[model samples]
Target: MMLLLMLIADLLILSVHGWIVYKTTKIECFPNARYIRNATCGIKAVNRYRSHTNMESDIVNKLRNVSLNLQIFLRNSANKFKPFLVNVTANLCSILDKRNFPAYTTIVMNILKEVSNVNHSCPFTHPLSTHQQKRLIVKNLYMDEKFMPIVPPLGLYKIDFNFLEGYPYDDVGTVILYIQVTDVKEFKLRTKAPKFVYSTIIYKTLSIECKYNPEILTNVTCQLKPINWQKSVCIWDADIPHSLKNISIHLQLFKIYGANNFLPFLINTTLNMCDVLSKRSFSVYGKILFTILKETSNINHQCPHEEHLSLYNLYVDARLVPVTLPLGIYKAVVRFLEGYPQVFIGTTVLNLEAMEKRERRGKVNKN
Candidate 1:
């Protein structure tokens, strides 16, 4: 009888523990910057809540010798806030390089990696141009409970980020973030969804231009026309010579820095067009190219001695733009080659721009 009673007790204990674990869904941490102040020349600091729960910080200008002082305050029983946890000051540059204070540094790096274009290395340099600045910061902001290296006890907590610069450590800015931790059951019963905003990256194409060699691919025609104020279509008609076999394509991307100067940004790579078309090999760049052109063009089948190849009224699908490219003029140079020697058959230079997407309120507006 005593053994049976002990078994009942064990079952009850296991059920209770399981219930507790199941109820604790996730840790809820939200951020809010109360104020931001910058007292240096050629620097701008702004902080505001983009939504009810998402906070955004926009700091323009390069940063060097930056130090960060972090403090955590907890609400106490006496209805007062007191320092209950960490209070440490560390050089931001050193943390980026050597990863000091790993517990805290991990959080900082995770946040920056998600929201901003700041490099993971030291001596942080952000985009300076107006269009580049617009693309640097993204709106989606939320901390996954699993990402936290260590979760504090459930309570109301305030975190202060004090930024300092130079040898004397002159104050650069301060940003305060508030956090609340609650049981998953309570969170679900009280909230409709996770108290975080998520959005997809959107971009608009400005222009496109293409060029090719007349001797190799005769009767070549390329044109871009505006379908509407916000949309455009590209048309290309080229005659491929019968002798051209085992073709390859080289793609290079350049971004305009200032004025009309275009500097190399990404992708100076070559791919075998025949392999891509014959489904023998599918590379990352090839997949992207196929995704963009598959729906509107007739370049899906295997390659050999070709006839005529054409793309008719091909629209640049904004959704197909895989990454968040900075707003500005961009040049894509595509070179078609023939045989193993890579004799250049044709060259096409495409000029385009990535622009911010405008919100649709009443009438559609262009940005």
Candidate 2:
């Protein structure tokens, strides 16, 4: 009887271990805000999402205070995120003075070491620049897989970092961060194919509008016309009297949320058009533009333009776009600048919509 019970206990332990090994968790953290009251110092904080998430905070200490107080609080979705689960407060300057830290202080020190340049013992006299703060914060704030503990229950978590100063410990500022934990099993079940498969995207141009400075570009004409039920073309013609020695292009993509309300979408970039034309360097969006314009325009040539330029029946190929973009109404603004001081010479605005190929076909048939 004893041997049989022992075998059953071993089987139960193996089952639990297998379950933990198979299950995986994903954690995403994003900055919520940084609020500071009336103070002599200045703080600038920004959160951006591009191909990846980035958070930056710049602190300008004009007062040159040596001591600082840091308070951390963690809240979860158990009580609808109303109450705090853990509250930790410590004197940062005092902690820096200690050679050996207690168990609770170790986690706080570890986090500061990973995210900032406060490795050495304090008195911290040197001023930290905005560039240095941005580099350190954005580069090192991500959580590593090895450092992640066992998967907690899937929910939303909020962490608040409150900073205080002076003898009375007045509030200086607060930086809020939100964390979301999700299970990989649900994600796998929802996505049938890979996330960025090119064949899945089907974008269509709805309209195009062009504006140019009459002094810079003369005899300008731009229009968009439908070739067939499935194809459209954009035609552009312009004349330039003086040679453009240097030029830059700024491209921004906005997703239309509601009537007359536009929110910035994935793509926003400014690059040297001359460098791209000469093939010196190209970004992902630049590559897309180059691929589309190479077949129909004179944009592939190097800089120094003094004559007429024309793009006859230039087709906007949807295949060149990033497949990760969702189906929605989108607007793209392209601005052209010239010379060293960067004078805005022209702008092109395109209103577009993305839909699945089958949905587009169905709409055409219904029309």
Candidate 3:
């Protein structure tokens, strides 16, 4: 009986040892591979667990496939809605309540970032000139890959600009925000040559009461209009100041659109600057003398246009008109001139070398 008990004890020890080894080496099977961890089950139930695990994996795969397909569908739908998105982004400020200006601005900026290709380069720094054929290539300011993982669909984007530090007065130039959008469908054409588009610019005032007055432009309302349209015909007008009667101030606004057309329309003067310069157009004008020999004894001559005194006639240059001005920036302020209520036309920088002079010296030569 004692011998039999010893043998039973030895068998029990072997079984426990085998069970511990099996538990340590057990392979855990999960329906979803993501949930697999430490697992131990007896050999008898291994096949049963695997059967359930396979079914669970199949179900997880099907769900994953559905999720992937849904993602693709949403992306395609967003592409279709991209153009409308751009319009909505541009018109956000118009639709939002006036009181929620901060929120409206934030949303618009976020939308712009989502749609725009991020470009960290400095703003374009070309001084706008009216005397030359000005051609500009409008593109995104930033094109960061992290901000823009996918390229936005090609379409027309309406860019809005404003000043950050409020409207600057004369002598201190204003810093205007420059926002720009490019065409989407015309990308191929844009790649070859820039295409122009027409858009409306609505001027506003700082307050609702000042809406009727375009002159009181707040930082938000003050922005330069895009120059993509055809050039306007410039008509020079004569302005005689009370102080200087002889000196004629040539008032000419930088190209007024729709004014030259057959249709009678006034330019949006609030957005324009009717510059006044001291130079006279008469200086550029020339006169010529003409003589014709007639078949008869009498000679006939016709002068082309009005003739001005020339060097041939020993005409002396007109006496220099000296108009004394203080050492300060001077601008001709013309108000209510363009039919707009209180429209103020101002001049930009008129540099004078005599008043503000700087001496230049060559770098010290090392002998």
lDDT score, candidate 3, position 127:
33
RMSD list, candidates in order: 20.4, 18.6, 34.2
lDDT of 1 by residue, 34-111 (tens): 212121111111221011122323344445677766666666678666764355566767766765643355555555
Tens-digit per-residue lDDT, 1-367, candidate 2: 0111111111101101111211111212222123221212111222211112233333333212222322222233355554222243556555556643422344445545554454545433224544443222322243433232222234445544555544566554544444444444434444454432233445667788999988889999999888765567788989998888798888777877758676755445677877877788645555666776688887668888778888877765665643345667889899999987888789999887766665333345644
Candidate 2 minimal-lDDT segment of 10 residues: 1-10
In order, the Cα lDDT scores of the candidates are 0.52, 0.50, 0.19
Tell me the deviation in Å of residue 329 in model 3: 39
Candidate 3 positional error at 255, Å:
16
Question: Which predicted model would earn the best lDDT?
Answer: 1
Q: TM-score of predicted model 2?
A: 0.49
Candidate 2 stretches greater than 4 Å from native: 1-199, 359-367
Instruction: Report clash pairs, candidate 3.
Output: 117-142, 118-142, 118-143, 118-144, 119-141, 119-142, 119-143, 154-184, 155-184
User: Any idea what lDDT model 2 has?
Assistant: 0.50
What's the alpha carbon RMSD for model 2?
A: 18.6
